[model samples]
Target: MRRLLEGVVPGELLLHYLSLLARGRLSVEEAPGLLDGAGNIDALIREGMAYCHGDDHSMLVAASPDLVLQRALARMAGHLAAEHQRLLDGQERLRAIQAPTDATAGGAMDQLVQILTDGGKIAELTLTLAGSAQRDWLILGARMAADASDATSTSANCRALYESRCVASAGERESVEAVIRAGGMVRLAPRVGMSMRLADEAIALLPLSERNPSGALLIQSSVIVGALREYFELLWERATPYGVPDVEEGPLPPIQMKILRLLVQGLSDTVVAERVGVSVTTVGRHVTAIREALGVQHRFALGVVAVQQGLVE
Candidate 1:
């Protein structure tokens, strides 16, 4: 089912139909032709892009694609939440099973911690943990020259916090941008003292030393994992979203602010214009103004700076 819809409908077509629907430009009469032109009405319906009505199912309607997409995303988030709870439950079960043995062996603390000194083994385990993440994957203090493949291999819901000074190079920026393109969320912190990875809210991988990547401590203790999770969240709230501005800018107009927020969310200029009741050219103008105001040379940088400046929450 997922594979069938992977590339069946172009995003532009969906957004166009939805924009028309929102503006009352798409009547029942117009929906048929547009849906037909889309060439995948069934897939559209499944994705909440189109609706069928009437006794003979002759009536057709276009739905707000954004609303439908948001609902779908909410469902995915609910599933991730449930999976996280299940992992916690399984940890409880394991603790119950190991109670007697742990008492005899001093404690389960020793069992929960594993040290790896080999570089190859550490790298392999990093990928393994990242690839197997089903819920949240939190990365803190990512290196400047970190491999993009590590970030790309994780689930779509990954969040990374990197030191601001580390990603100064264009190559590092590209690597971080690749992560964003792959659906990973990134934030920049002025300083990130420790490098850590938390997977599925169940396990954590911490480098044994800041200067070395060849040694790590893999921990499955809930106490430690929960503490790390809280720490990550604290840093996440304080850190700026990955794009920092080179210059301070004045506040934007309300309409431009609205458009900027939408743009930062990966919406197209066409969609932003439609949503804001402006022309596409107007959106482009506003984008250009925003880029100049933020001292950025590109759209991606514009988004990052908007986020960093609190223009887009």
Candidate 2:
């Protein structure tokens, strides 16, 4: 041990001891034990002296356990300071590179549209809603919300404007009803502040940051809106009419199921007739029969009820 300390105890040995200290091998009271023993004291003294080489000069002069701990902390602080400074410098450089390119113009809406059209990034957020009916409103509101959402997206796809249409037809509403009845969530805020328009759908909602409203950042390319539309149809199907009585779930036959499936898939009576190998008049007869069976006022309602009843599988 004496011979090991004669020339200089290596940095590896000092690092090993530091690692032990870091790992709780030496408790606070046990630090004094490190200074005890015949050859141990000399070994430590020699190791302390050997710290003089390169950048370890300050560590060698640090006397006492506190002083040694402070030196080690100072080295750590210096390393962290360098890393922090590098991050700051890189951030500053990126800002300098980007600042000149971001030129947004016009009113809030126009500027928003310009920014989106000119290449703005889309932000996605998860929003919580109020109630099931409000959930209905929110679904309706997304059509209204589409324009506002589009203006927020960067490099907003032109098709996004068309895609933004909130197509919550009676058929779609049925889908929403189904989802809600199935224990899926749907909600909306009764009071919306800002108005949004994307083609046929329009939504007005208070700014999300201020209050619980209908507005949110929408991504047209993303399936969320489409999925929401499908969900709306589900709910619309199962939801009782707002002013009307709750209708009973009536029985639908397998033939009605086949007819409803074709209708829901956007097939016209003539096309359905061709597909079913029946005449158009025969298809009409089946449609009338299905509508009567479902007790719906219209063919659209018939489609909705059929879907809700699982007639289309």
Give the alpha carbon lDDT tens digit for every residue of 1-21 in model 2: 323322233454554445433
Regions of model 1 farther than 4 Å from truth: 1-110, 144-147, 244-313
Candidate 1 global TM-score = 0.45
Worst 10-residue lDDT window for candidate 2 reads 155-164
lDDT of 1 by residue, 1-313 (tens): 2233234445655554555456543445556476565455556566666677666666566665456556567767888999999999998888788665633223443468777676665666677677878877778886412334677676425778888876799877887766554446678999877899888888888888888766788888899999999999999999987543333533654565677889888999899878988667546655765665567898888767877877766
**Model 1 score (lDDT):** 0.68
Number of colliding residue pairs in each model: 0, 34
C-alpha lDDT of residue 266 in model 1? 91
Point to the candidate with the largest TM-score.
1
